[model samples]
Target: MQDHTVISSLIVRVLPDHGESAAARLASIEGVEVHEKLEGKIVVTIEAPTVDSSHDTAASFSEIPGVIGVDLVYVNFEDDPAVAKGSQR
Candidate 1:
């Protein structure tokens, strides 16, 4: 196995909806990057050193006025047993 550090990412769908400009601004944040953005829902992916960094990025998204909610869908090298097995299988 290769020695690698786990990099967690947060997939966020911006809520309350807003303009493409605002979403662009959100994506422009230092560590945040936009993976996809359609309509009022913007999918953002943030990679950080630790889970806390992921959570911190999520919290930053919530700070955006139009943002309604933040959801974390995946993390680096997901720790789920089923997922791990599925990857191998």
Candidate 2:
């Protein structure tokens, strides 16, 4: 089966005191990348093989001890292997 690539960006809000820890936790999750972090907000990008997986990754952010909210900012899905290969040419 061809892989479906899903890319999403999220904003995660955490307790001010736990910002660093929360960012580290988020970075530890598979397929999650911490792009930027402020006092209590983190910008993250999740790359997965499917939309469900991407959503699951984002949802997991909310389960962190100090996380207050998870907001999805952007999402994209790419499922064309031929187009993917063609792009590389």
Candidate 3:
């Protein structure tokens, strides 16, 4: 089987005082990248082996210190090779 990954972006709101700490935690996660930060919000991208894992990873952000809310902003789904083989171009 071929491996496909799901890529997505999220807006994470955090307590301003702990913004840096939260971002560090997010960056420590595999497939999670902290891109930008302002006020109390952070922009991040997350990738996972599957959709369920992607959502789960996003939800886990709330566990970080100072995290207020996690909002999914964008998603780029990868084409599954097995499924692609059955479809016509």
Candidate 4:
């Protein structure tokens, strides 16, 4: 872990019949924010403590019931924590 903040945005697709349940489930996950839902697609944002966790979180979205796909739109890892790890501040 680099002590950096990792934020990622993604789209999750599900069958239209399952959109509501899937969106609720996704929003219940830690650090997962469900932004919008239309048709069978949902917009979401995930905030994780590390880059690897961000990936893991995204991958887990596929396991949700009725989820057809998880498409990552963007990921940002704030700065380089490694550069300041040795400093007291």
List the global CA lDDT of all models. Answer: 0.62, 0.85, 0.85, 0.86
Expressed as tens digits, the lDDT of each residue in 1-89 for candidate 3 is 33546789999999989999999999998889999998999999987776777888998998898999999999876564433555655
Tens-digit lDDT track of model 4 for 1-89: 33438789999999889999999999999889999999999999988877778888989988999999989899887542532463545
Over 4 Å off, model 3: 1-4, 78-89
Best by lDDT: 4
Residue 48, candidate 4: how far off, in angstroms?
0.5
User: With candidate 4 superimposed using the best TM-score fit, by how many Å does residue 17's alpha carbon deviate from the native?
Assistant: 0.7
Indicate the worst ten consecutive residues by lDDT in candidate 2.
77-86
Q: State which candidate, 1 or 4, has the greater TM-score.
A: 4
Clashes of 2: 0
Report the lDDT tens digits of candidate 1 across residue range 1-89: 33323344454454444646658777788667777777667776665545555566678777776676676766674643444667797
Per-candidate TM equals 0.64, 0.82, 0.83, 0.83
lDDT of 1: 0.62
Candidate no. 3 TM-score: 0.83
> Candidate 4 regions off by >4 Å?
1-4, 80-89
When summed lDDT is taken over every stretch of 10 residues in candidate 1, the lowest stretch is 1-10
What candidate 2 gets wrong by more than 4 Å, as runs, is 1-4, 80-89
Error of 3 at 85 (Å): 12
